[model samples]
Target chain A: MLDAFSRAVVSADASTAPIGDLSALKAFVASGNRRLDAVNAIASNASCMVSDAIAGMICENQGLIQAGGNCYPNRRMAACLRDGEIVLRYVSYALLAGDASVLDDRCLNGLKETYAALGVPATSTVRAVQIMKAQAAAHIQDDPSEARAGARLRKMGSPVVNDRCASLVAEASSYFDRVISALG
Target chain B: MKSVVTTVIAAADAAGRFPSTSDLESVQGSLQRAAARMEAAEKLSGNLDNVAKEAYDACIAKYPYLNNAGEANSSETFKTKCMRDVKHYLRLISYSLVVGGTGPLDEWGIAGQREVYRALNLPTGPYVAALSFARNRGCAPRDMSAQALTEYNALVDYVINSLS
Candidate 1:
């Protein structure tokens, strides 16, 4: 699922490589912009893999905040999904914009809000957003090749899935596990 | 929770006191624990967590930058250029090694070499200074600047030339 989104992100960006003369390259890039636009649309739809993954994990945990077999909001498990959706949307937009530099201020701000709302630690979450932004900035000087950009998007997704976003998922699941076991 | 958080922050700060290896080793234990707790609790709120998370997120988000050998290649080129300058500068001052005739080469006689080495030494002092400052100030050495490298280069010249 994540792999598909990764491919979509990479394929969406126009290549910065010089294929012929300067004019030809620009023309190629201009023409490719439409393709990139299409890719962004595809990316928005495809990135649901992240949310789905988190949701499934929560379900597997017996619904941490379950009320009648469904996880209730405000519970740790539900909070994780909420946070995941927030981050996923932000990340998807950033990727769709085809510019990672735009992520720091906007994305980080949203992350801070989510953490505050979920009663989770905002420290790592904020740092994760900042790190994500810095990562994007570092790539500003890079050539906009689909392969290169896609590789970066994919790499960036790990922190979302494993560290920041996924970390929340795992944490919620663990708490649910503990509560369920303790209750049993 | 606050106590654990405080300890972790202090440990992270203190870890900056030693050399890179020790600093990292010292912090890793506390940091890992703190990180785990934050992950487990899903309730982290502190400046330290903020900064660490920022760095972590930045690292994760920018993972692609690290994968690109091209950036590394460019940085290496920059490093090579700087080193080349150092070598050239070093050779220019090797004349001092020959000037060693009586009581430590004086400023009046071998002043040019002395000055060159002194210029070089200025940079060297900071690398040493930066490490010391990082220890005292409690931070990472890489947080120091390239100016430190340049300073170290100068200090090497000063020590070499002064050795007679």
Candidate 2:
């Protein structure tokens, strides 16, 4: 049950270690990373875990943005867009590492929607959003017009806009707030 | 302003708890939930950015008789700029969390939370637990529902008073 804060206290406790092993945390962090990677290996599929973790952090911030009123539109959009990138990048890394279960379908959709809002080019960016959209769109669009596959292609190939981005931001905010209030 | 102050005070009075990775995970989970809800709120019949936006917009749009105003700007250039940045930093935390990664997400959580305190003209001390609580709940004192928020609000008051 040694939480991060308690570990800090335990390390700082003069009675226990004489000199605090501040560097111990670095090792602990490395271990945590390994554990995370191991967990991914066991899961086999990229679990939405990382995305879920980061998603919560984003929601907390969005509530504050809404509170600040609409003064910094450019920064606001930029901030949301940037966050979207971070989440997308993290998901990409997890996926590349062979953890497909790290993100759920809806969240995967979120990544796609967010990247689309940024007007990101499909083949250029290393972002998972770009890769997924490009590959998926090409696969879907190749199907015949009257076929059900084409309809599915149309659903997946649609452009995502800033409005959707805003909606995501708002959703993350509410979800985070409620979870926090309930977790205690 | 009153609700904010009240919440801050209530938070300040709560017994502090050392944070753990689980706490961080819990914090992260809660925030993600909040983000999802925020998106849903945006899609709802009414356009509200959580409870505050609902209140702010309602007070602004339908209430034609009311005047919505911002904080007064200082006459001194340096002071004004500093104040603005401080508030921006606070707002940035909220926005960054909501939108995604903030530029300063690299800062450790406690330090990052402390940055908010500094911006708010509060002193930094051994209030990691308190700060965590505040962040987990957000800065809106009125929006708080649980006992943690009450205690967190008290802690905020104590910190603010201790500094002043």
Candidate 3:
């Protein structure tokens, strides 16, 4: 699995190969690294933004106006934020490590805690996570290179690395879903 | 305060049942008054040693079932339990008022539950599950059994009576 992941990552890296000048190739790699750093920053904070957006949507739908006529999430929204943070961290770890197996039983238990805290069934929790992902995706969509950078980060955290990290994270999520269902 | 209590009682009597969407305006009025009274009491009695005792006595007086409930021995404990139960009941009521209908309360999708949480100005995390549990247990007045329904009404009335 690691060999195939490595080859895939190497192939993806090769696709961005610079022609002619070695200095140009170095510059291209340097630029990609900068974009990757930006992507990481966005990814790290995406969960909080998603949680806040979800809370805003809820507050708007329910007409929960605060003293200032502005709606804000209460403590419960904090729980959702916590859950999102956990998922994002674990998924990012899995991607960076290029091994979903790193998310073991302990990790699954943590996921369960989020599901329980969110007070929704596993399926509903999954839907909520999907919504978060969509929100995150939308936020970066306007910047095509940044979006590509994010996509690259998912597949491989750095352009220099050669591992299908994104696929591992996807598998990790599926594994999480199975475990959650089994827990039920 | 007395007028608010009177209004809630009158509405309960007129409906011949616990308050529902049919008399939502009255229900909302009672809810707002109850909330106001709680806030006032909390503010006026701030840091007072006997505040919990007073709240306990008031709650037990209105809903005797709250009295002698095992393990709620101290005034503070009793007060805490009473407030928790009251909040739970009130959230359900708020959910019904905002969401309407008695059609499988637990089945409210993410959007639906969000609406309920938002309507109550509640936090959106564990409380969502808590609300889901209440809905699953048929906490809506119409969904309750005869005895359960009576107890629910008594609980709401107790809040109105205590606050007023």
Best by lDDT: 3
lDDT of 2 by residue, A1-184 (tens): 1223232333433232212233443333333333232222212222232333234444444432344422135675455445444444333322221222223332343544554676533222223233323332232232224464464432323433423223223322333232222212
- Which digits, one per residue and each the tens of the lDDT, describe model 2 over residues B37-84? 232212221211242233333323443332323322223553345333
Question: Once superposed on the true structure, which residue ranges of model 2 sit more than 4 Å away at CA?
Answer: A1-184, B1-75, B99-141, B144-164
In order, the B-chain TM-scores come to 0.20, 0.27, 0.26
C-alpha lDDT (0 to 100) for residue B36 of candidate 1: 25
DockQ of all models, two decimals each: 0.01, 0.01, 0.01
Residue runs of model 3 more than 4 Å from their true location after superposition: A1-44, A56-73, A104-106, A113-124, A136-184, B1-164
Stretches off by above 4 angstroms in model 1 are A1-38, A41-51, A67-83, A110-117, A121-184, B1-164
Error of 3 at B104 (Å): 55
Candidate 3 has what TM-score? 0.28
DockQ for the candidate 2 complex?
Answer: 0.01
lDDT of 1 by residue, A57-107 (tens): 554455344563323555654655554444434343333222332234433
Name the lDDT value of residue B149 in candidate 2. Answer: 38
State the fraction of real interface contacts model 2 keeps: 0.00
Q: Which ten residues in a row have the lowest lDDT in candidate 2 chain A?
A: A93-102
User: Could you tell me the TM-score of candidate 1?
Assistant: 0.23
Candidate numbers sorted by TM-score from highest down:
3, 1, 2
